[model samples]
Target: MSSETHEFKAEVAALLNLVTNSLYTNSEIFLRELISNAADALDKARFQALVDTSLDGQELESQILITVDKQAGTLTIEDTGIGMTREETAQNLGTIAHSGTLRYLEEMQRARAAGESSGAVEPNLIGQFGVGFYSAFMVADEVVVTTLSGKPGSEAVVWRSRGDGSYQVEPGSRSQRGTTIVLTLKTEAKEFLDRWRIEALVKRYSNYVMHPIRLRVIDEQGEDKDPEPRQINAASAIWARSSSELEDSDYTEFYKHVMGGFVMPGDEPFARLHFTADAPIQFHALLFVPGRAPADLFQEDRKALQLYARRVLVVENCDTLLPQYLRFVRGVVDSQDLPLNVSREMLQEHKSLAAIRRQLTRKTLKLLAELAEESADKYAKMWNEFGSVIKEGLHTDGGQRAELTELLRYRHVADTDDGLVSLKDYVAGMGEDQKYIWYVAGPNEAALRNSPHLEAVRAKGEDVLLMSDPVDEWVLQSLSEYEGKSFRSVTQGELDEPAEDEDIDDKDDDSDDKDDEAKAKDKREPSPIDPLLNLAKVVLGDRVRDVRASKRLTESPSCLVDAAGGLSRNMERILRMAQPGTKLGASPRILELNPDHPFVTAASKISETNKDDPRLAEWVEILHDIAALAEGTVPDPAGAAKRFTKVLNNLVAG
Candidate 1:
């Protein structure tokens, strides 16, 4: 038989170039992609054999055998499954039939039309294009694929392609059915020829594939005449094992084995859910919520959950296991029922898979709730690391939102000094007529604790949950209500009347006298003092949409609260960092003051007696400046400095 080469189609050339140069940066992925394809072929064959056992004559033995020859610089992946015909090989490989390239291109066009920049949409485009097979070009200079269809009398075919945009197809003879991919490694990619390297990559990327993945590695013994190739994969699904047989350390090790990192022993998982279900689909899953959120969890380019089939690994990072909100979770999910050749698009639409996802999501949330109930300390630690992500679920996933809400923790009046408390605890501690779940959002625990907005609630002995996490405000916005209780931001809107019995009233005549004295001291007299407040508001007009006397102030002379439909100070700071150049709305805040405070009383009296005193006017300006600082806004330093000097001169002359 004579070997020949042929030119590739124009699009094939572009696809090859993309795969070799830009598709993947890691060369080891070529091994994973090939092994996954082999496992898929074996799975298909096993499915077919169940329908017609006579096709192979012998009982179907499904396995993926990988051979690496260091001296020859060649790596081979073979499988025994329903193979392909000459036409099938031509369609699958010679072109991009199985690759999701067309769909990827369509997605790219759609993304571009949706106003996404080219750079922003690039990394998210994967799998839909059939070019994954061509990713072999990332490491290999040349590739040869030999496939024999399972049907009797079907001739085996070999398809060869160089890293360049061309390929050739020819007929070959093979005794067994299935496919084999041979990669002639390039000089720089010789590491792939090492037995250890190949084994490591297999464990890293294909450990969860459904069929047995056998690697040809030299068996080490006391005496060796010649090295014989042996299988390397674990060949069994870890998820299928009983939970009792596994230790926490064992789980951590397995996570490291699949995740490819040294998982520390002290690193406790945020939440772990291990279960099996045969109903909708046969699957065994061990999912873990990391004790800490990954830096990439909120990154625009999010990684997917690792996917496994049976015990052998199919896809290293599979996004089909859970929704995007659960991206912070890391683990393996092995299913025996799903089709091996299921496409990404199909995975999205697959009802069985959807059912599986819903079940897994609920299981994960339930595990978290259990953690919170069983060990509040550990769960609180977990919330510190991943509460924001769970809060995200509370916002986006409506079905599980209620469950997620119960799992959420916050700093409330009752638990403020103690630590974090759950919504359940807050509800249990609620006063009889408390209709709304109240919370205050701020930069930190201290800020929220000192917020004037919580004064009235605290006075009534009601607990106001403190939301300090940068994500808290958004989470609250997404989850408008929980468990029939509407969530209200204490600082954003007006509060309903306190429980009737808890009303503030003077019990004695002396109490009445004290009340009158306090009112006289605290109340800002209606005089030129009002105009000074108005002048300050006008000077800071658009910067602050509105400014008014605050009823919430107690000890602090002044504080700022978000105007209607505006972000809290903490939320604004967070947004400023996340999206640069995004304009924030001008929120006029209530300039709250403690009416009975000595400084306000002194200022009111001084302004009244010396209406034309420039020093008194300067003092009035200083009071507003001080108030702005307490409210977390900086006054104009230059103006503040000038006013300070005038006040100092007046005091020195007096």
Candidate 2:
């Protein structure tokens, strides 16, 4: 038969140049691309054989074979699958983004719409963007494709191209069905001719391909030994199998494979969410929450979740599939609904992907909720490992705040041991007089439990949640309330006195006596602490918004509180640490004093005796500095140290 030559379409010529140079980031991607195309062809042949019994490859087992000839510096990939005819080869390969699988699916959809097709039989295939075939030019100098159509009477055809904007078509004489691609490796790409390198690329990208992928190595000593083609891929598609048939060990093994040994060999996942969804979008997933988090889990560029299309991997670390907060989740998601670009290295921004993400997030959260309810001990252990990361979701995903809140666990001020409290349990135990959910944040649980801001609350037998995680500060900023109750920081805003449960008598008889006692006490006391408060405000100047007596403080001499609707002290400190020199952390806070404390009493007496006393101003400055230190910050270390030394010297002299 005569061979014919044709120049690529002008647009295709420009596109071919892009595919060979810039389309794929790695040269090794060409192997995965070719394997995916071969797998797609195999799928089409299997589906066609069901309807047409005369197909040529119906009796042969479908598999992909990779052969390396190190002597010739060439690699060949052959598959026992459907092959293309002369016209189909030119149309499918000579163009960019013209997918054969997409066309086949469209035809099936049209058939179903016209009542010509029956049942839900669909082709499960990959290679959505036909340009995957042209990725070969990224590594090869010349490429040759020899294929024989699976159609009974169809003849074999050969396609040749140097990827220089021209291609040749010629008649082939192969007796069996399917296609074979041979690549003459360029000088720099000869590493692909090594057997170990070929094995690695296959396992990395196509380890779970539905069909067996076999490899053969022909050394310089010739093919005298190792006659049989050994299979390289697992070909199990573990996620696609029925969960009922899979054992726990099987799941663990697959998790280890997918996670690339990120977890220890014997370490089991804390929880696993395995389910198949068909309504919103068809997908099979196996998600695992590792028992221990990686050291780099919080890195900004860390990736999670492997995304696959019909068993062929589309992306190794699909960051788009899960939000950054859920980046600790490790597993595989296999779906055919996602759209891929030319290299299949990245996913296109499609509505289906968004739907998948929403579904996966809801499912993951639900799994955590179930774990917390059904298994307390196990869930507690998992929470201890990942609670800080999960708390981030409360601030980022407002829509799921309620669900996330149910998963929160915190140390309570009343807890003597390491026991944790949940919002639901805390709300149930709340006193009728308690109007808001009170919480205190500090450097550690010990510091937070002993916080002076919770003194009055403890005296009233009310429990305050203790938070020590650094992320807890930012988390509380967005989590304003849980379960119809508002969240209040014990260190923010003016402290409100808890309402007394005792009922007041309606009789007017005792009203005059109570009023007389109050008037006499007010006349005698005459607001002795008022002088100290006014003097401290003047001494501190704009460093504090106001200085006043605290209703919340009992043991501590002083504490800092932000004004109503102002940023909490802990949150401001976190912001300053994350972004140094940020102006957002410069808000002045209110300083509240405990008038009953000895230090406060002595300072008040000094101010009453003489407002200009040097000791009075030094004591006020020391109180402010101590309050700053209590909140895990240092406003002015040098000035505070000098004042502290003077106070110590005066105490010794007295």
Candidate 3:
């Protein structure tokens, strides 16, 4: 047949050049790319057959076939799936369909010019940009594609291309309605001709592709002795199997396949949930809490699950199936209920997918709860590795706050060992009069343990949770209360009133009903530390909202507290770091001084006798600086040092 020659589009040529030269560091991935395309073609055919019973490919077995000719230095991959005609072949293979191809080419060129060995673009972009087919050019000097459309009366076509700027398309003869690809391997790519290497690559990347991949290898003499091809893949959807029919090893193997590689090769999954839901929407899920988080767990676009439709792999790294906070999960979710032609845009608005997501999240949380109940040590270890991530859910998932709160574990002032206590345990251990669940957040456990805010709570023998993670402040804000007990940040609000002693419950109604005159009389009387508090407020001015005698502090001279509804010191620090050059300290905090402390008593005497003494102002400044230091930050390190030096000099002179 006469062939029509066509020059590739500029973007396609550039992409071909990049792929053949240095786009992928791992050359074996070309096989994976080809295999993935074949699987997708099969999926399309199966879905089409469902819609149109007369589709020509429906009679063919749904499978992929691989044949290697070592003597000829060529490899072939054939799929009994949907195929393209001459025009479709030319358009699909000769041009770039993605709009970002130009941008991608520019980025690659820049990276190459900068002496980068690999492209700067994400590896997945090759697939997303609709040029994954070109990856075959990376290993083969020449490639030939023979295809016949699944549509009735469609003509067969042949597309041939070398690692050059042009390709040729012509009429071809094929009785089957599918595509066949043959690659003339480059000298260096001959390693792919090895039967063992081909098997390994298939198992690594396409083991769970949902289509049987059959292999037939020719020996050095080019004679195939095997009568039939051997299936290389398990070919069964692991998630679709009944949970009772699967074992731990089966689950672990599937986890490795879904995660793309042997991540933490020595570690088993921390936990897994395998179940089928047939009620609201039929779906199967096999979710895993990885033994440890992937290295890119915190990356913004990192995806942790694979979405499938009718056992056909749809989205390879599907992020929409799980919340961002739960990106540590790894598994596959398959449902025939979803449209086989579902798009990412449609997945965003699809009510069925949303319901599936919600159910997956609840099931995951429930799995964790069960793990914690059945195995305490195991749960604690998982919490240690992943608690910070789970805390994010408390901040972002309001509907799951109660569940996430139950999942929370924290180190407290009473923890003798490095153990975490849950909120339930903390509440159960609370004193009868303890009105709030107290917590203190700081840079670390050491800093939080030394916090003056926790001094009174500790004095009362009530434990306060030590929160050190950056996300803890936001989490506490979202979880304002748990089990009817309001979460009170010790550093942000008034300290708890002293717990009343049950042995001393005698009181008279006359005293409770005292007249307004008696109340006024009580208000007029000033305590001994009132002078020190009043003087500090004046000297500090608006830097502090108010200066008051402490019901919280037992030993520290002074400490800062967020006003009625202002940012705590830890929260302000987080914001300042997150948004630089923004005004954030506009809201002043209250300064509370310990009434019975020696420094306050002596300072009160001096302020009462001589309110204008310059030394008293210096002492007040010193008090404020000390409070800031105790809060794990120095407002002005230089100023604080200078004042401290002056105080040291004055003391030396005296």
Q: Number of the top candidate by lDDT?
A: 2
Residues forming the 10-long window of minimal summed lDDT in candidate 3: 497-506
- Of the candidates shown, which would achieve the greatest TM-score relative to the real structure? 2
Write down the TM-score for model 3.
Answer: 0.69
TM-score of 2: 0.88
TM-scores across all candidates? Answer: 0.69, 0.88, 0.69
Between candidates 1 and 2, which one is better according to TM-score? 2
| C-alpha RMSD for every candidate | 11.2, 5.8, 12.1
Task: Write down the worst ten-residue block by lDDT for model 1.
Answer: 120-129
- lDDT for model 1, please: 0.67
Positional deviation of 417 in candidate 1, in angstroms? 4.1
lDDT of each: 0.67, 0.83, 0.78
For residues 1-654, could you state the per-residue lDDT of candidate 2 as single tens digits?
A: 689998887677788888878988888989988999999999888888887888887789999999998777789999999898777888887666788877888898898899988574678877766788898998899999999888878888999899988999999987889999999989999899888898988988899998999988888656623489899999988788889999998988787775676567545788898888896788999999987886679787776888988888778888888887788998989996776776778788888899899999999999999999999888888888899999999889989888988999998887878788899999999999888888887667877876788888889998888888889977877877777787777887655622122133442444553463343334443355999999999999989877888878889999888665456666776887888876774677788899899999999988888989988888999899888888666778988888889878988999
lDDT (Cα, tens digit) per residue for candidate 3, span 91-161: 77777544232343466568678886342223211223455677788889999999998988899999999
Model 1 lDDT tens row, 68-145: 766567778888867888767766676664643344347657967898634532321123446668778888888988
Report how far residue 8 has shifted in candidate 1, in Å.
16
